[model samples]
Target: MKVLVTGANGLLATNIIAVLLQRDYSVIGLLRNEKSFALEPHENLILHKGDITKVDSYDALLPEIDCIIHAAALTGQDIIDYSVYQEVNATATENLYKSALEHNVKNFIYISTANCFGFGSLDDLGNEEKPIRFPFSNSLYAKSKLEGQEKLLRLAKDNPDTKLVTLNPTFMIGSYDTKPSSGRLVLSAYNKRVLFYPPGGKSFINVIDAAEAVVNSIELGVHCESYILCGENLSYKEFYQKVTKQLNQKSSYVKIPKFLLYGIGYIGNLLRFFKVKTDISLTNVQTLCINNFYSNKKAQEKLKLQQRSIDNGISDAIKWFKLN
Candidate 1:
């Protein structure tokens, strides 16, 4: 089968492409740039440079694609442009769904985030069936992703021929992060850049396992269904200790007060009002404070998913970061 993967240059997309190639499937990557990451030459792999939001950009490649792994999105802590988020995450997905219907794509796996389900506790973990809690009122990143996911799910229900499956992956860490987005946390911990720790915890997952579930969904996934791809939940302190151990460093961080962090967000909003360029924004503060502990019971039972300790992910990420 020929598969077209959007955001082929991203961390998760790189891993997903590796798995698909190992399975002997012909892969066409729809990426904004071809030189973002260094990939080995393969007869089955073709990199098609194009923008996903612009239908004319990838319209030609859609005809031969049997399946699509939609992994492209505008994600960041410093992102304040709401229009860019809507265009890339929401409207682009709407256009892609329409094109998928026209091209008769067999399977479409949309990658969503676990944050859409809202913050939850260990006693009651977040699940796919749960309605997104005030998605529009949430951070710009989560709100945009949920909008795209909602449109795809609705389209899936209306069109029975096109198989659609959604997978919400939690905080993922692994190798091949050329841009070093999520892996920066592991680097920060290993290098002792993280002086202060957050009070909340979050679910973690190895990118390899996340990619495996994405591939498994092509065969085992049911139509119009959503699954949470999650792993062990750990506090920021525990997460730092694990990374410190792997790096052979001492772990000691001052526990930052929650109110101080809230104040930081409040001040960040104030800075935005003056159109300032700062990393510590309201969205970033919310991410650090929100406890995103999710359950992957649905993915584990249905996709036969297996999750290793988060340490493995941190170790691999550090090794890759050091080498590259």
Candidate 2:
């Protein structure tokens, strides 16, 4: 099998590439720039440099590719224009999906986020069947991803051969955390420098575990299926404790009240409006204070997504942090 993976420089993509190579699948990584790829060379792996928003550069290679894993995106809660967000997260996905379909790619694995579900602290987990309720229009990142998901599902209607599989992961944590999604907190806690603890719950999946689910979906996944790839449910406090323990450090963290955080966040927003840079963001207060545990029973059953334990993940992270 020939697999083309985007976002080859990311933490999850590293494991995906390694897994594909180990399985003897020909892997092609679409790198935005060649300098970012520093891993040891592999014979089965090929490199392609191009932009996902433009299909012209990959027009020649698209036809021969068997599978395409779309992992490229600018994912963040920062204030950015809708047009820019759509161009990278939505428009780019549409272009790639269309090109993959036109080129007869067998399976298209789309790396999606569970954040598209909505804003809430409820323990309600998201799955394929649950309807999506986008919380806000200003949710440029979430809205774009949801639209991308819709596009892929709709494509399955006319093109049954081009299967679409989505893996919705919550706070991914583990090795190769170069971009360090919430995992860096492990290091921060160990260093005894985690300034504040957000009052919230977030479901986390190991990066390697997420990679395993991606490959498993390619091997055996349902069409138009959205699998929530999550693991142990922990509050921000518990999550940091894992890190602190791994680092062999005991640090006391005081949980700030939600309302107090919002007040500070509002000040942060005000500061931003006044062209003053502050370490706070009012828009991010609710996002930081909500419960976000997701269930992965579907992925566990279908993809056999065995997540590496949070302890193990934190251990690996500590080692990586020490080395880096």
Each model's lDDT: 0.86, 0.78
**Candidate 1 residue runs with Cα over 4 Å from true position:** 134-136
Provide backbone clash counts, one per model: 0, 1
- Compared with the true structure, the alpha-carbon lDDT of candidate 1 equals 0.86
TM-score per candidate: 0.96, 0.91
Stretches of candidate 2 above 4 Å error?
118-124, 133-138, 193-195, 271-280
- lDDT by residue (tens digit), candidate 1, 151-233: 98888888989899889899899988989888888877755744578887889999999999999999999999888999998
Q: Evaluated with TM-score, which candidate comes out highest?
A: 1
lDDT of 2: 0.78
Error of 1 at 234 (Å): 0.7
